[model samples]
Target: MLKSMRENVKSLKWVLWLVVAAFVVSIFFIWGASGKLTGDDAGNTLAVIGRKKISGDDYLQALRNRIEAIKSQYQEIDRAFIEQLNLPQQVLEQLVEQTLLVEQARAMRLRASDEELRDRITSIPGLQQNGKFVGYEMYKRVLQYNHINLSEFEHSLRQDIVLDKMIRLLTAGLAVTPDEVWSDYQKASDSAGIDLLILETSKVSLDEAPSAAEVQAFFEARKGAYLIPEKREGLAVFLKAEDLKKEIELSEKDIENYYQANLSRFTNPESVRVGRIWLPFEGKDKALVEAEGRRVLERLGAGGDFAALARELSKDAKASGGGDYGFYDWQSLPQPERDEIHRLTSGQTSDLIAEADGLAVIRVTEKTAATTTPLAGASAQIRSILLDEKARQLADTRIAKIEKEAKSARSLETALRKAGLKGESTGLLKNGEAWSDNDPSGAVGTALFGLKEKEVSAPVYTYTGVGLVELRKVEAPRPAAFEEVKADVETALVNERKMETSRARLAALGRRLEEKNWEDIAARNGFEFKTVEAHKRDQYIAIVGESKTADDLAFTLPLNEASAPFDFETGTAVLRVRDRKTVTREEFENVKETQTAQILNQKKNMFLQAYLAKLKQEKGIQIKYDKFLQLTQDVLSRYESAKQ
Candidate 1:
């Protein structure tokens, strides 16, 4: 259909014009279209790429689309994971790069054809049903479900295609040399054998413990390192929601209201318990795989037990357990597999279904229909949820009232009594220190550090409950008296002496390597002389720990030449190369293609990085770091609010 449409230039021109008209009409509804953002609207701008402003709303929508894509692959995602990704920063950079590419493409008079855009949209599998395009309705529904506007998605798609074309045009001529390929193959396949002497810190022992006077002198000389941590002492008045629950009373009307509002949460999707017999391709003849699949199906059809056949013939990891794949909803499986499963009833088996690498035979052992819990059934859960909400609200209100009264109160005790709560004093605590197990969330600790002596803190939510805090005293970090930390100082001094002694002994042993055999010296010192045979680069040596230095020394040093003591986290190592091997012609030939591909990929990545750097410099990219950070914080705050 798209080919025919592309062939007719007149129709294509009309379609392009219609798309342009629709884009122009939709600009009013879009959050920050060019020339439309001003005043309060202009504040929403996240970044500016030349004349184009990427708005906060646009960035957030893009982020949501990305999150939805990830959620499809992973069931449970959390705020910490999202924050770790630095998604807001990444999204902003992507938008800037995209805008740069689009500008360059337009400068080169490049445009995506109407037919090309149409083909791209229809080609997306999500917009198809029963192996055919489900038309515009299904496309609209997909966009709606993902919180994307149709116009915005189409615009983004066109931009992506244009940018991809630009990238291909720029990177078309990259190639790898034969010499580079051979070097990569040699690096990957070459192995080395070595004899190693291992000396560990734990092996070093002191003859005697340091005296109390010596320990005191050592601490006195390094008093700065022994200064006490700064601490704060304060009083906390807690307002627990569980305590507030005693005062909260829910009515039948409230329970019914909650049930009606959150009915979706009470509904369960249809699911299936399935067993599969898989015959993986494994470079075997495709005919053999298909025949095996058919044979399994025939056995099942002839009343042969599915589990017994699966255990005997299937290649899947679950084959050992009768190929039981456990429970799955429609969305849990790939569309092709899901469609095949949907065609089977409980106790019925599927025909051979071809996959990317294998053929699978599925038996729907059991099926469960979708269900919605009745009002009575859901009432108990709804009541619990409502009660928790009310309790939190009541706690917040009480804490707020307590905070107001505490500002003028002479003591936290008076304030607590007024608020109908108990107050406890937290003995001197370092910043970030918890008081017993009371403030496991560290809310009190965080509050206390920011408060001046005798100052009351505003209400802050904590893991245990809501609370108002008052800082009673501030303790500055100071050097401890000699007697106060004598035991710690003794321990430190002893360890330092042991390390010095070990270094002296290792240095003597390293010098003697030229005079005596390494094995004889190791035996004299009761150390193990271990040999690692035929290990490649990037492989770890067991006795020397996972030291790359030891591996490199083995490869670099000549035969029988011992290295100087190489100090690592664990201890020191003396490595001597025993033997070295080079890649043979036959070995190189076997891995030639794979090694060439790896080298080419590495070169391509480097080239792409350099090209992008040049483009960014040419475009005179500028970013306001403060504004970016502020926007990121705002986004995270909104996400946290939504989760709550």
Candidate 2:
């Protein structure tokens, strides 16, 4: 369909326009077309996506924005985890894709109309209050606070709208057939039971231990494997948040100021846990719905079970769970319900209330009045906060001075002595070794390793507080002594032999599997034989664990036919399908429509992705690898510097 649409562009233009009209009413957010195309700066261009160039600054800003977004999700996000995300590559890919999409929209003359743009902006939940736009002034102020240019933001948002329009236009022709849906449903629902023999590698033993000659030969062959990394020695002084508490002093005025500044921290809003039995007015007599609401209220008033009645009679989605809406902050409950709830005490039922769609009888199972801790009551916590804040400030000042002194004196010991502070000796530590768990990203080691012998480092943030490190000594990497690595070499040799023996044993068992009873064969070979209950093909098999190989063999192998040995990280396994379960005709029919919709959506995504790839190829996307690497290093370095 995509190929046909591309080949007959003029004929399908009207059809695509009609599809675009149909889509505008449903999708809230959409991609926009290109704005202000600029020539690429050779030195700064990160990538060229067709005519539009993504500059280094643009990539950095986008990367920072993405990091900020991720920070909100992970409270304790660290550099190691961020690096693992490989976000530089991902962000660049996204920018290139977005640019391609915007260009495509421009070519097709697909644009977001002024009215649609206005609707999209106003409908942004952050820019609205109580389901109405907060007006242009407040919206502008909010954007200003976040350092966003109003025009730039809108253009970016418009680009998103146009990009989405182009994608939807392309994918609109894709379809999923009823037969395809049924096939997908059956594939996902099919299950199998299997007898598995897992030969534990750890339990496998070598027939005999390797001789000293063998160990020596292995060590000689891989001497670099036992090479010790360069080590550093240093005297380090640590400052902790708690250590500076003695120097902190707070006045009553200080506590009061803090209490006012952080008022929300001390305030607890009033809330109610409400349970409701709703009788909808739709497709039923209004009077009958009102009568049902009254009956439910009466039952609750007479000390009857509210949850039981709600489960039996309520038409709401929460009916199965006893119609509990959990807790709602006082200001969040809608008008009539809020007023009625406030009047009722805990355990009291509300009178039949008329709602737009239904009559509801709500019960207040619990209520908590709003509270703000008095200044006097919060004084202790306030003092603690003030002390921590002041201590950190003091630590920063002292560390800054120490860093200067250490740099000038060229000795951490001299600097500490002059400052009347004692330092602890960090006995020689190897490069890449974790000196402190709080410094998991190994910033301290990186700083120290980059220094010459006897050189002191700038202040390093250690999560707990701030400190400085000095490279007192440097040990060059060297091959390990025979005695020093004897135990390690022996262990490695034994483990390797065990693995080799396990493979051979499994192979022997595989050769005899068809001729012998599985249990008897496994027991004779010192392997464990087990059977897992029937489970879907995708489901985790506790006995077999998580092996795609095992799963495939269990389902594909004929019943009573044994499988050959399959290797796993921890063990080796042979499997036999004992029983098989397939999706029933009734089961397939029950979810046929839902399965069809899911398959359609999946097909649409696949088509869109392939279309984008083709477009990208045609546009001749080019990335400057050296510049990309420099940008990645800059991002990581900035992050590290910020930690310091």
Global Cα lDDT for candidate 1 = 0.69
List TM-score per model, in order: 0.53, 0.58
Stretches of model 2 off by over 4 angstroms after superposition: 1-116, 119-195, 199-218, 221-236, 249-257, 260-263, 328-334, 372-380, 406-432, 436-441, 449-458, 470-484, 497-556, 578-644
Top candidate when judged by TM-score against the true structure: 2
- Which TM-score value belongs to model 2? 0.58
Backbone clashes in model 1, listed as residue pairs = none
lDDT of 2 by residue, 1-644 (tens): 33432333322222222322343212211221123234377767878877788787667766766675565344345557678898877777877776777677889998878887888777765544456775666556555543546786677667667867877888888888777887788778888878877877689877788999999998988888897778887778778767788878888999999889878657756766788787888888888888787778777778889999989998977889897877632223345666787788888888887765687787888987888879888788778667766776688789878888988888888889989999876667766555665456565677678787888876766545677888877888888987889989988888877766766777776457775467888778788888777766666766556788987887789987878777777767778888899878899888888899899889888887898899988999877544565566555533431221
Model 1: per-residue Cα lDDT over 1-644, one tens digit each? 44432233222222322333344223212322331222236667766666666666666655654554454445445556677887766666766665666678888777777888898877664444456775675456545543456776677566656766777777678888888888777667788888777777678878887877788789989887877878898988777667788898888988888778767666755667888888899999999888888778778988999999989998977899998876632234334566788888898888887765688888899887878878898887677566666777677677767777777775677878876778888888878777666567676888799888888876656544677779988878888877777778887787777667766676787467774467788889966678878878777677566677876786788887888777766666777887898778887888788888888778877987787678787767655433454445434532331221
> Relative to the true structure, how large is the alpha-carbon lDDT of every model?
0.69, 0.71
Superposition error at 130 for model 2 (Å): 20
- Count of clashing residue pairs in every prediction: 0, 12
